[model samples]
Target: MKRRNFLSLGSALAGSALYAGAMPGAAAAGRDRLRIGMIGTGMRGQVLLRELVRRDDVEVAALCDIEPIMLGRAVQMVTAAGKPAPATFGENGDGYAYRRMLDSGKLDGVIIATPWEWHAQMAIDAMQAKVPVGCEVVAGVSLQDHWNVLDAQLKTGTPYMLLENVCYRRDVLAVLRMVRSGLFGELVHLQGGYQHDLRAVKFNSGDPTKPYGGGVEFGAKGWSEARWRTEHSVRRNGELYPSHGIGPCAMYTNINRGNRFTRINAFASKAAGLHDYVVRNGGEDHPNARTRFQLGDIVTTTLACDNGETIILQHDTSLPRPYSLGFRVQGTRGLWMDLNRSVHVEGISKPHEWDDARVWFEKYDHPLWRKYGEQAAGAGHGGMDFFVIHAFIEALKENAPMPIDIYDAITWSAITPLSEQSIALGFHTLDFPDFTGGKWRTRKPIFAFDDRY
Candidate 1:
């Protein structure tokens, strides 16, 4: 895992094609339907399973998870959808059971919904096994993990897509259309962040009936995300979950396509929210109250781009607040802010007055949404999940490049480690790694370029 010079490595590897074409066993090669596999059947994994089962073009070929209860629940879901029971693994506490599923030679592609730490290794294993991968957010924990995953894909020529659904959000896509069409004019500064209250999610009771709140427990006593996600908050002080915020922003600026993040500096506020929540909800004398959390209540990171646009991101999950990504896209002529759902233009809007963004969003709604809005309904995360999954399937079926390719995946996920490095060094600005090997200068924008995907 020694750090290799990406600039030189990218230069050496730049000539090779990076498109995600059909693999040897892909459905694109004469198969009637896709044979897919599921890696984790937890709460989030179940949501993905529901979406997969509903797709007529896909079959849940295999399932894996350490918890049998979750595995049973997922089995019930597939059966309820009328799909055949998929081969199940991980029931015997084998952490590497997923590797067996990948080696089974029954999968066309795999969707990884496992915990964050497992994402990198599973993806690497899938690529090495020549299985196409649609992995959930934060591709890897360390910067080297990103490089390793990228290297695996380059060596094996396997398709890998980061299931970053926020990039397909209705308003976010609409703004993307606007940005491409010059509605926002020349892009200047943009802001987005994961600024939602997750105090309850960070500490959930193990009770099945009351899974989210009603208790202050984590690790063995916690449920779902509480079991693992809270551990990161307790050990790290950076933008732990940044893809939701940076994904759409990267799309707007064409990050890792024609532009790239050059450098970044991050600042973190003193830690207080998690402990305060425990004291207020669970008594101060609660055993968990004594646990120290390292994650800041609010972490702000500023990134400079090679294209002259500056991006700011904030991570604020421990505090109490209504959910909002805090998205703001500004340019020389106009700006859009998701916090207030308002937009302002130099001439289209009144003199320095804000206009309802709904009008503009409706006018420029992405073709993909306009065409598949009905189909996307009821899918998780306000229906964006359907689009992300659809993109993966369609790309694999067509043997075309992924809309969100490996370069984009690593660049977006690299923010977490880079932000951590910056904060650990007294908010020092650090040069961003060029994961694309300087190929970005010629890479054209494909994400949401049309409704076909």
Candidate 2:
């Protein structure tokens, strides 16, 4: 489809209240089966494909990937599910093969799970093709890339959602309910982070059979994420992956809906984790051990919001540590910390003591989880992946605006580049751009506002 034609169609679709308010059952009179496409059929793409095929309302119409092995595996998965074989792209290793899929007029929507650098341009092309997008984390690598995406969505009026599943995590959602119910009592400060060791994920043998943790190889000599993800550690210094931590925190503080981040400051520890891993796993004589990694072993960023709430986010992926988002939601009355799974209420608990968070989580489990917990079993990421993907497909079928919309996508992603700039300037604070263009003052929180998918 031509860009101009798609823009007109998108504008007309926008006029039909597609981007307005939620209208349950609105799309029942529309299509009975939605046609979906997959881009970057790597490990993450395979997981999403598994969930998509599990649904009766979705048809896996097309698949695209530069890697022939991954693409073939995805096709086999669909056919094994008793669905028709999807049209495949990128057999010849053309990076732009996704453009052909987008222009094929066969896809109602596209789910992107490509490397970090390719996210923005691919999403822009999909939106311009009049296809809704459910994109993976970190919308763009640069600040201007984010603005460009925002401009494309604004101009085309296409639906774009960040496939950030962490926001729907059971305990996170429970804490969100607590915040909204005034249990937190006027939010003050919050903290969350990507504090997991990724040494094994960053290095692997090029052989697909040994997908992870057998050798210290990256870039062209690695498989799956190790092929691309580790290169960022060698070339950049920033909070490269921020959505997993910031998405839920944004919900708690109402970011981009009557609240927005205004400024940010960041700091980074010395770069040693990746190099140490290389030396430990492959010895000092390994070629990768001599490669200078620019990314810090630990990166910390602090953000100030318009509503006086403060947020601290840490990016600590290269070190040795158990996985944790290290969430701490504090307010006037009390606080909840995920690190120890404990909560403290000024009067609810014994003075200066902790209560097991499990009781609180059970008492206030998210309504959506309570309703779909059984169905979500076996879905990735503790079944939160089911919720995020469900929200995308349901919104498409209902013709409603996405729960986590374009503004939310860029707002969370812009943190990476902004943090890099902050760290470059010796931990100096920088102004956070308002991607909503002043609409944040009036925009309302729609994420997980109801139990409906």
Candidate 3:
């Protein structure tokens, strides 16, 4: 695709994919339309399902989940679109929804928004079935799951992506511009975290209709309440949730462009509040209580990439605070701590100390900001949700490389569990997995959504 035309496609398809380089009128077959099925109907799944249904070039042909109620809800949505309602699967049993969707010749790909643990397995299953897959990330739920998926991708010869949507955030695009344009000279250290207070949400593992917190864990195996956390407690670090904070940071460091994380060391707070709250809140207290969560409530994960630049990723969900994922990137020249407080060559510390971060950061009058700034700057998480979905679809339709790929997905997700291991140990430094076999640095950069940079 031509350079200008590539950008045009990105802005056009929004967040879906198409067969790029094909003849203009060749994308006519129903198969060319890229039929997609959704697995898992929870929070994340619902969002992706709703989002994809809006794209005219795509069709959702399957909706699957263990819970009949959720499946029914999704079916209602499909009917509302005036499209054929999806064939529901996994009404009972282990709920192999992805596999069920892949069985249909009508589906060319699947989007998995299942719990983190099932992500790898479902993705691999889809690939094996010769279906393209877009999976939710935090990397893989298990070390072995990671290995299996990578191998599967290479073997199946299908497009596989971990949806690290945060790469499309508005402020994030601004940061990328700074990096590509050399505003943040040689960004050496970056900081990010997904610190939300999920300690209070009540979940029931035996029942999918209830809150999704209790009695669920992600691993090579699917959701298991067997460990007993689901029966009566909360668990963290069991799944290593990453797709949130890690997404944007990975893009900033150019993980796909060969900047790889060389090492990481991390620590987690001792399990306290969640466990105590579970026991206090009528959760069954039993022998496994001691074994329930060795993971700390607060986990501070540090990443050191091959470029010798490190990014700090923190996940603290046990705390009872307002939802926040601090995306802080610091370079030798200028540093940005939040949405506003950016210090290029002057007044860096002043902005950091002030309240109302936007008061200092919002530069609505800036040229780049003025150009592609309004809707996104105020959209989901400052309009990032829209930007990311939009960019992904356009790139797929154009057959352009996505900014976040499997390589980025692996490294970013790997940090969570790897750092958990580090924190489990006495803060020992562990060599980060070479997801790309160490060839990451020599790769050419892909076009970022923010062309202004």
Model 1 clash pairs?
A: none
The prediction achieving the highest lDDT against the true structure is 2
- Model 2: which residue pairs collide? none
- Candidate 1 lDDT score relative to the true structure: 0.86
lDDT of 1 at 202: 79
Model 3, range 45-145, lDDT digits (tens) per residue?
77666666766767788888886766787888777877787788888745664565687777756778766677788888888888777776654756777
Q: How close is every model to the real structure, measured as TM-score? A: 0.93, 0.94, 0.79
The per-model lDDT (C-alpha) reads 0.86, 0.89, 0.61
Candidate 1 on 236-274: residue-level lDDT in tens? 999888889998888778777668899999999999999
Candidate 2 has its poorest 10 consecutive residues by lDDT at 1-10
Model 1 TM-score, 2 decimals: 0.93
Candidate 2 ranges with C-alpha deviation above 4 Å = 1-20, 23-25
